[model samples]
Target: MIDEEYAKLLKQAELDYEDNKKFIMVLKKIRAKSLDREFNMLHDKAFEEIDCLKCGNCCRTVRPIYQQKDITKLAKRFHCRPIVWEKEYTDVDEDNDRIAKTVPCPFIAEDNYCIYYEDKPKFCRDYPYTDKTRLRNYLRETMENSKICPAVYLMINWLKESVNRGTLS
Candidate 1:
């Protein structure tokens, strides 16, 4: 069963996604430096205000791309062979990259805690990519991720406000 807060966040995320889509092309043209500074400032401020533990939405909805090194580390952690890990926990993406097959990462416990919190992949640790270097791509992906991540919703709202206030310019 989904947590109540998670459900609410998902609904709000869907709405935010629709609202933010109209700005994509314009956002794509934003200068990299400006976008980066704005993103960093916004990310810092937003994170200070929001608590991810209140809603571990990302862990509950998406898989992180796992590099070969990550696979090796995870396999070692589980005391399983790398090939066994690949067969049991992951699949090759369209690009032939190994990624978790299960959404809501298999390591997420029933209680919303990560079974491998300390050993989670780099992608998981740096999620909701907030750097301006990939703002266009981030926006595109975040819009889709809003279906399951409240952090995306919060980020979108922050972006909208920043844009309106001319801080993002």
Candidate 2:
């Protein structure tokens, strides 16, 4: 079951995103001591409470881009040639990047489980891209992912609040 408070928090974050975005842009550019540490703390906290099994919006909504090297590995899982697997399972997006052919991903089970969870692509494993960073480079992607990853949505909102309150400095 979705945690009711987390659901409420995400709803508020989505509604507040546009209003909070300008500030988030500024926050993104600020390089401060322990900033990534602070962000990561919140990221870890959110993950503890928000279960992916309760929400697979990332898989249902966005396909992870598969780079060529990963494609060969992914294809091997099915015991197929990379070229054949790409033809059968993926297509090039507008960005000329390869992505899954289907929405609600062919690999995602009905109960929000990914059939490919163990051998999923790096991007799938790193969905929301929250862990690694140069925070400045991640600003745009962070904002976009906030809606999909509850952890991101919560962390960004908390960051905005802390920065505005002069507490995170």
For each candidate, what is the lDDT?
0.75, 0.78
- In model 1, what lDDT does residue 54 have? 64
Give lDDT tens digits, candidate 2, residues 46-156: 788788888777887788888887789879898999999999989999999998888767888878787877778888887776666566577767887887678888788
Lowest lDDT 10-residue stretch of candidate 1: 130-139
Clashing pairs in 2: none
Best by TM-score: 2
- What does candidate 1's lDDT look like per residue over 55-134, in tens digits? 77788677788888888889999999989988999988889888889987879887677788877888888787774465
Candidate 2 ranges with C-alpha deviation above 4 Å: 1-10
Assess every candidate by TM-score. 0.85, 0.87
Question: Compared to the true structure, candidate 2 yields what TM-score?
Answer: 0.87
